[model samples]
Target: MPSADRGVFSLIIINKAGGLIYQREFQAGLRKLSTNDYLVLAGTFHGVHAITRSITPRIPNSQPPPSPATSSPGTAPAVSGYSYPNPGVAVTGIDYLETDKFRLTCFQTLTGTKFLLFTDPMTGNVDTIVQKIYELYADFVMKNPFYQTEMPVRCEAFDRHLGAWLRGRT
Candidate 1:
Protein backbone atom coordinates (compact mmCIF):
# COMPACT_ATOMS: atom_id res chain seq x y z
CA MET A 1 0.00 0.00 0.00
CA PRO A 2 2.24 2.78 -1.28
CA SER A 3 1.28 6.39 -1.99
CA ALA A 4 -2.20 7.06 -3.43
CA ASP A 5 -3.21 3.44 -3.77
CA ARG A 6 -3.57 4.02 -0.08
CA GLY A 7 -6.28 6.52 -1.01
CA VAL A 8 -8.19 3.64 -2.46
CA PHE A 9 -10.72 2.79 0.23
CA SER A 10 -11.72 -0.66 -0.97
CA LEU A 11 -12.34 -2.91 -3.93
CA ILE A 12 -15.09 -5.40 -4.67
CA ILE A 13 -15.47 -7.91 -7.47
CA ILE A 14 -18.81 -9.22 -8.66
CA ASN A 15 -19.61 -11.83 -11.25
CA LYS A 16 -22.10 -11.41 -14.07
CA ALA A 17 -24.65 -13.23 -11.94
CA GLY A 18 -24.23 -10.46 -9.32
CA GLY A 19 -22.59 -12.62 -6.70
CA LEU A 20 -20.05 -10.94 -4.47
CA ILE A 21 -16.87 -12.93 -4.93
CA TYR A 22 -14.29 -10.59 -3.46
CA GLN A 23 -14.38 -7.60 -1.12
CA ARG A 24 -11.38 -5.96 0.50
CA GLU A 25 -10.76 -2.71 2.27
CA PHE A 26 -7.53 -0.85 1.52
CA GLN A 27 -8.06 2.20 3.72
CA ALA A 28 -10.03 3.14 6.82
CA GLY A 29 -12.17 6.18 6.10
CA LEU A 30 -15.46 4.29 5.91
CA ARG A 31 -17.33 1.89 8.16
CA LYS A 32 -17.42 -1.77 7.21
CA LEU A 33 -20.58 -3.55 6.06
CA SER A 34 -21.62 -7.14 6.66
CA THR A 35 -20.93 -9.72 3.94
CA ASN A 36 -24.66 -10.05 3.27
CA ASP A 37 -24.92 -6.31 2.67
CA TYR A 38 -22.12 -6.45 0.12
CA LEU A 39 -23.83 -9.30 -1.72
CA VAL A 40 -27.17 -7.50 -1.78
CA LEU A 41 -25.51 -4.32 -3.04
CA ALA A 42 -23.80 -6.13 -5.88
CA GLY A 43 -27.01 -7.88 -6.96
CA THR A 44 -29.03 -4.68 -6.75
CA PHE A 45 -26.52 -2.73 -8.80
CA HIS A 46 -26.40 -5.45 -11.44
CA GLY A 47 -30.17 -5.41 -11.75
CA VAL A 48 -30.23 -1.64 -12.04
CA HIS A 49 -27.50 -1.66 -14.70
CA ALA A 50 -29.38 -4.31 -16.68
CA ILE A 51 -32.63 -2.40 -16.37
CA THR A 52 -30.96 0.74 -17.65
CA ARG A 53 -29.57 -1.08 -20.66
CA SER A 54 -32.90 -2.72 -21.46
CA ILE A 55 -34.79 0.56 -21.27
CA THR A 56 -32.48 2.25 -23.77
CA PRO A 57 -34.40 3.91 -26.61
CA ARG A 58 -34.18 2.46 -30.09
CA ILE A 59 -32.38 4.46 -32.75
CA PRO A 60 -34.30 5.89 -35.69
CA ASN A 61 -33.33 4.46 -39.07
CA SER A 62 -34.26 5.18 -42.66
CA GLN A 63 -35.31 1.64 -43.44
CA PRO A 64 -38.51 1.04 -45.42
CA PRO A 65 -41.77 0.75 -43.59
CA PRO A 66 -42.49 -2.58 -41.94
CA SER A 67 -45.31 -4.84 -43.07
CA PRO A 68 -48.48 -4.58 -41.07
CA ALA A 69 -49.52 -7.40 -38.72
CA THR A 70 -52.49 -7.98 -41.02
CA SER A 71 -50.26 -8.52 -44.08
CA SER A 72 -50.40 -11.83 -45.94
CA PRO A 73 -49.67 -14.86 -43.68
CA GLY A 74 -46.35 -15.62 -45.40
CA THR A 75 -45.10 -12.02 -45.22
CA ALA A 76 -42.21 -11.43 -42.82
CA PRO A 77 -43.03 -10.00 -39.45
CA ALA A 78 -42.05 -6.40 -38.68
CA VAL A 79 -38.62 -5.85 -37.23
CA SER A 80 -38.54 -4.88 -33.59
CA GLY A 81 -37.32 -1.35 -32.77
CA TYR A 82 -34.13 -2.85 -31.38
CA SER A 83 -33.20 -3.91 -34.89
CA TYR A 84 -32.27 -0.32 -35.83
CA PRO A 85 -28.69 -0.15 -37.10
CA ASN A 86 -27.36 2.64 -34.91
CA PRO A 87 -25.84 2.26 -31.45
CA GLY A 88 -29.09 3.15 -29.79
CA VAL A 89 -29.07 5.23 -26.60
CA ALA A 90 -25.45 4.26 -25.86
CA VAL A 91 -26.07 1.98 -22.91
CA THR A 92 -22.56 0.52 -23.16
CA GLY A 93 -22.14 -0.11 -19.43
CA ILE A 94 -22.21 1.40 -16.00
CA ASP A 95 -18.94 3.16 -15.14
CA TYR A 96 -19.04 4.86 -11.77
CA LEU A 97 -20.92 6.33 -8.85
CA GLU A 98 -20.19 9.68 -7.18
CA THR A 99 -21.31 10.59 -3.71
CA ASP A 100 -20.49 13.38 -1.31
CA LYS A 101 -18.16 11.19 0.70
CA PHE A 102 -16.81 8.66 -1.77
CA ARG A 103 -16.42 8.00 -5.47
CA LEU A 104 -17.06 4.46 -6.63
CA THR A 105 -15.52 3.67 -9.97
CA CYS A 106 -16.67 0.53 -11.73
CA PHE A 107 -14.62 -1.33 -14.32
CA GLN A 108 -16.38 -4.14 -16.16
CA THR A 109 -14.39 -6.84 -17.94
CA LEU A 110 -15.36 -8.18 -21.34
CA THR A 111 -16.45 -11.45 -19.77
CA GLY A 112 -18.93 -9.49 -17.59
CA THR A 113 -17.15 -9.66 -14.25
CA LYS A 114 -17.17 -6.23 -12.59
CA PHE A 115 -14.58 -4.49 -10.40
CA LEU A 116 -15.84 -1.81 -8.07
CA LEU A 117 -13.28 0.55 -6.55
CA PHE A 118 -14.26 2.83 -3.71
CA THR A 119 -12.03 5.81 -3.12
CA ASP A 120 -11.96 9.12 -1.38
CA PRO A 121 -13.94 11.70 -3.32
CA MET A 122 -10.74 13.71 -3.83
CA THR A 123 -8.70 10.89 -5.31
CA GLY A 124 -7.24 11.48 -8.77
CA ASN A 125 -6.45 9.39 -11.84
CA VAL A 126 -8.88 6.67 -10.75
CA ASP A 127 -9.65 5.78 -14.35
CA THR A 128 -6.00 5.00 -15.01
CA ILE A 129 -5.76 3.00 -11.82
CA VAL A 130 -8.85 0.97 -12.61
CA GLN A 131 -7.54 0.21 -16.09
CA LYS A 132 -4.28 -0.99 -14.57
CA ILE A 133 -6.23 -3.16 -12.16
CA TYR A 134 -8.03 -4.77 -15.08
CA GLU A 135 -4.75 -5.38 -16.82
CA LEU A 136 -3.35 -7.03 -13.71
CA TYR A 137 -6.43 -9.16 -13.40
CA ALA A 138 -6.06 -10.23 -17.02
CA ASP A 139 -2.40 -11.06 -16.67
CA PHE A 140 -2.29 -12.54 -13.20
CA VAL A 141 -5.70 -13.85 -12.22
CA MET A 142 -7.13 -14.82 -15.60
CA LYS A 143 -3.91 -16.47 -16.65
CA ASN A 144 -3.31 -18.44 -13.47
CA PRO A 145 -3.69 -22.21 -13.81
CA PHE A 146 -5.58 -22.63 -10.54
CA TYR A 147 -7.79 -19.56 -10.98
CA GLN A 148 -11.40 -20.18 -11.91
CA THR A 149 -13.34 -17.67 -13.95
CA GLU A 150 -16.17 -15.84 -12.17
CA MET A 151 -14.93 -17.08 -8.82
CA PRO A 152 -13.28 -15.28 -5.93
CA VAL A 153 -9.78 -14.20 -6.87
CA ARG A 154 -7.20 -16.09 -4.83
CA CYS A 155 -4.05 -15.82 -6.87
CA GLU A 156 -0.97 -14.75 -4.95
CA ALA A 157 0.51 -13.53 -8.22
CA PHE A 158 -2.42 -11.20 -8.77
CA ASP A 159 -2.05 -9.77 -5.28
CA ARG A 160 1.66 -9.22 -5.70
CA HIS A 161 1.41 -7.61 -9.12
CA LEU A 162 -1.52 -5.46 -8.10
CA GLY A 163 0.16 -4.33 -4.95
CA ALA A 164 3.42 -3.57 -6.72
CA TRP A 165 1.69 -1.67 -9.50
CA LEU A 166 -0.38 0.38 -7.12
CA ARG A 167 2.58 1.04 -4.89
CA GLY A 168 4.69 2.17 -7.82
CA ARG A 169 2.03 4.43 -9.22
CA THR A 170 0.80 5.81 -5.94
Candidate 2:
Protein backbone atom coordinates (compact mmCIF):
# COMPACT_ATOMS: atom_id res chain seq x y z
CA MET A 1 0.00 0.00 0.00
CA PRO A 2 1.13 3.54 -0.73
CA SER A 3 1.40 6.28 1.88
CA ALA A 4 -1.71 8.15 3.10
CA ASP A 5 -0.25 11.46 1.99
CA ARG A 6 -1.16 10.75 -1.65
CA GLY A 7 -4.30 12.57 -2.79
CA VAL A 8 -6.15 9.87 -4.71
CA PHE A 9 -6.45 6.22 -3.77
CA SER A 10 -8.74 4.52 -6.28
CA LEU A 11 -11.85 4.80 -8.44
CA ILE A 12 -14.84 2.61 -9.11
CA ILE A 13 -17.47 3.11 -11.83
CA ILE A 14 -20.84 1.47 -11.36
CA ASN A 15 -23.44 1.33 -14.07
CA LYS A 16 -27.02 2.44 -13.51
CA ALA A 17 -27.95 -1.21 -13.00
CA GLY A 18 -25.47 -1.49 -10.10
CA GLY A 19 -22.88 -3.46 -12.03
CA LEU A 20 -19.22 -2.69 -11.63
CA ILE A 21 -18.03 -1.19 -14.89
CA TYR A 22 -14.60 0.13 -14.05
CA GLN A 23 -12.09 -0.17 -11.22
CA ARG A 24 -8.68 1.46 -10.97
CA GLU A 25 -6.17 2.05 -8.26
CA PHE A 26 -4.30 5.35 -8.41
CA GLN A 27 -2.25 4.81 -5.25
CA ALA A 28 -1.50 2.00 -2.81
CA GLY A 29 -2.69 3.39 0.50
CA LEU A 30 -5.88 1.33 0.54
CA ARG A 31 -5.91 -2.40 1.16
CA LYS A 32 -6.46 -4.64 -1.85
CA LEU A 33 -9.83 -6.27 -2.29
CA SER A 34 -10.69 -9.11 -4.63
CA THR A 35 -12.66 -8.44 -7.80
CA ASN A 36 -15.67 -10.31 -6.38
CA ASP A 37 -15.55 -8.12 -3.29
CA TYR A 38 -15.57 -4.97 -5.37
CA LEU A 39 -18.56 -6.21 -7.34
CA VAL A 40 -20.48 -6.96 -4.16
CA LEU A 41 -19.63 -3.54 -2.81
CA ALA A 42 -20.96 -1.86 -5.94
CA GLY A 43 -24.26 -3.72 -5.79
CA THR A 44 -24.68 -3.03 -2.09
CA PHE A 45 -23.96 0.65 -2.49
CA HIS A 46 -26.44 0.93 -5.34
CA GLY A 47 -29.22 -0.57 -3.24
CA VAL A 48 -28.42 1.69 -0.30
CA HIS A 49 -28.31 4.75 -2.49
CA ALA A 50 -31.69 3.94 -3.96
CA ILE A 51 -33.21 3.52 -0.53
CA THR A 52 -31.72 6.80 0.65
CA ARG A 53 -33.14 8.72 -2.29
CA SER A 54 -36.61 7.24 -1.93
CA ILE A 55 -36.75 7.96 1.79
CA THR A 56 -35.47 11.53 1.52
CA PRO A 57 -38.00 13.99 2.88
CA ARG A 58 -39.12 16.66 0.45
CA ILE A 59 -40.00 20.18 1.51
CA PRO A 60 -43.74 20.78 1.53
CA ASN A 61 -45.26 23.40 -0.73
CA SER A 62 -48.26 25.52 0.25
CA GLN A 63 -51.26 25.83 -1.98
CA PRO A 64 -54.86 27.03 -1.68
CA PRO A 65 -57.55 24.47 -0.96
CA PRO A 66 -59.11 22.94 -4.04
CA SER A 67 -62.56 24.14 -5.00
CA PRO A 68 -65.42 21.61 -5.12
CA ALA A 69 -66.10 22.45 -8.77
CA THR A 70 -62.49 21.52 -9.67
CA SER A 71 -62.62 18.31 -7.68
CA SER A 72 -63.77 15.17 -9.46
CA PRO A 73 -65.39 12.18 -7.79
CA GLY A 74 -63.12 9.15 -7.18
CA THR A 75 -60.11 11.13 -8.51
CA ALA A 76 -57.20 12.26 -6.40
CA PRO A 77 -55.49 15.60 -6.99
CA ALA A 78 -51.85 15.69 -7.91
CA VAL A 79 -49.59 16.65 -5.02
CA SER A 80 -45.84 17.28 -4.96
CA GLY A 81 -43.17 18.68 -2.71
CA TYR A 82 -39.97 20.58 -3.39
CA SER A 83 -37.06 18.24 -3.87
CA TYR A 84 -34.29 18.02 -1.35
CA PRO A 85 -30.91 19.82 -1.91
CA ASN A 86 -32.70 21.93 -4.58
CA PRO A 87 -36.19 22.56 -5.89
CA GLY A 88 -35.75 22.06 -9.61
CA VAL A 89 -32.82 19.69 -9.60
CA ALA A 90 -33.58 15.98 -9.67
CA VAL A 91 -32.49 13.86 -6.72
CA THR A 92 -29.13 12.16 -6.87
CA GLY A 93 -28.37 9.74 -4.09
CA ILE A 94 -25.69 10.21 -1.44
CA ASP A 95 -23.07 12.64 -2.74
CA TYR A 96 -20.12 11.36 -0.76
CA LEU A 97 -19.05 9.25 2.16
CA GLU A 98 -16.16 10.24 4.41
CA THR A 99 -14.26 8.11 6.87
CA ASP A 100 -11.24 8.83 9.01
CA LYS A 101 -8.97 7.20 6.46
CA PHE A 102 -10.54 8.17 3.12
CA ARG A 103 -13.31 10.00 1.33
CA LEU A 104 -15.47 8.45 -1.37
CA THR A 105 -17.18 10.85 -3.74
CA CYS A 106 -19.95 9.81 -6.07
CA PHE A 107 -20.87 11.65 -9.26
CA GLN A 108 -23.85 10.40 -11.20
CA THR A 109 -24.34 11.68 -14.71
CA LEU A 110 -27.65 12.76 -16.20
CA THR A 111 -27.91 9.38 -17.89
CA GLY A 112 -27.55 7.61 -14.53
CA THR A 113 -23.98 6.38 -14.97
CA LYS A 114 -22.08 6.82 -11.73
CA PHE A 115 -18.43 7.61 -11.13
CA LEU A 116 -17.05 6.73 -7.70
CA LEU A 117 -13.83 8.46 -6.79
CA PHE A 118 -11.76 7.65 -3.74
CA THR A 119 -9.35 10.21 -2.34
CA ASP A 120 -7.38 10.93 0.79
CA PRO A 121 -9.56 12.33 3.56
CA MET A 122 -7.75 15.68 3.42
CA THR A 123 -7.84 16.02 -0.36
CA GLY A 124 -9.62 19.00 -1.89
CA ASN A 125 -11.31 19.89 -5.16
CA VAL A 126 -13.05 16.54 -5.38
CA ASP A 127 -15.87 17.90 -7.55
CA THR A 128 -13.37 19.18 -10.07
CA ILE A 129 -11.74 15.79 -10.25
CA VAL A 130 -15.07 14.03 -10.76
CA GLN A 131 -16.15 16.47 -13.49
CA LYS A 132 -12.87 15.94 -15.32
CA ILE A 133 -13.35 12.21 -15.09
CA TYR A 134 -16.81 12.60 -16.57
CA GLU A 135 -15.43 14.63 -19.44
CA LEU A 136 -12.84 11.99 -20.16
CA TYR A 137 -15.49 9.27 -20.08
CA ALA A 138 -17.55 11.21 -22.60
CA ASP A 139 -14.64 11.85 -24.89
CA PHE A 140 -12.97 8.48 -24.79
CA VAL A 141 -15.56 5.88 -23.84
CA MET A 142 -18.73 7.35 -25.34
CA LYS A 143 -16.96 8.38 -28.51
CA ASN A 144 -15.43 4.99 -29.15
CA PRO A 145 -17.31 3.12 -31.87
CA PHE A 146 -16.67 -0.22 -30.27
CA TYR A 147 -17.82 0.82 -26.84
CA GLN A 148 -21.26 -0.13 -25.55
CA THR A 149 -23.28 2.04 -23.21
CA GLU A 150 -23.36 0.94 -19.56
CA MET A 151 -20.81 -1.76 -20.32
CA PRO A 152 -17.43 -2.32 -18.73
CA VAL A 153 -15.01 0.29 -19.98
CA ARG A 154 -12.28 -1.32 -22.06
CA CYS A 155 -11.18 1.62 -24.15
CA GLU A 156 -7.43 2.05 -24.21
CA ALA A 157 -7.84 5.74 -24.94
CA PHE A 158 -9.89 6.16 -21.79
CA ASP A 159 -7.25 4.48 -19.65
CA ARG A 160 -4.51 6.58 -21.22
CA HIS A 161 -6.36 9.88 -20.85
CA LEU A 162 -7.44 9.16 -17.28
CA GLY A 163 -3.93 8.21 -16.21
CA ALA A 164 -2.49 11.29 -17.92
CA TRP A 165 -5.04 13.59 -16.33
CA LEU A 166 -4.46 12.25 -12.82
CA ARG A 167 -0.71 12.25 -13.29
CA GLY A 168 -0.87 15.87 -14.37
CA ARG A 169 -2.92 16.70 -11.31
CA THR A 170 -0.40 15.17 -8.93
Give all TM-scores, in the order shown: 0.76, 0.86
Q: Clashing pairs in model 2?
A: 2-28, 2-29
lDDT (tens digit, per residue) of candidate 1 on 2-100: 445446888888898888887877665578899889989889888876776676566655575565855777877876644423554345456788887
**Local error of candidate 2 at 145, Å?**
0.4
Regions more than 4 Å wrong, model 1: 1-6, 59-90
- Full-model lDDT for every candidate: 0.77, 0.86
Q: For residues 22-112, what per-residue lDDT tens digits would candidate 2 score against the true structure?
A: 9999875468999999999999989988888888777656665566688888878645444465767787779999999889999988777
lDDT of 1 at 39: 88
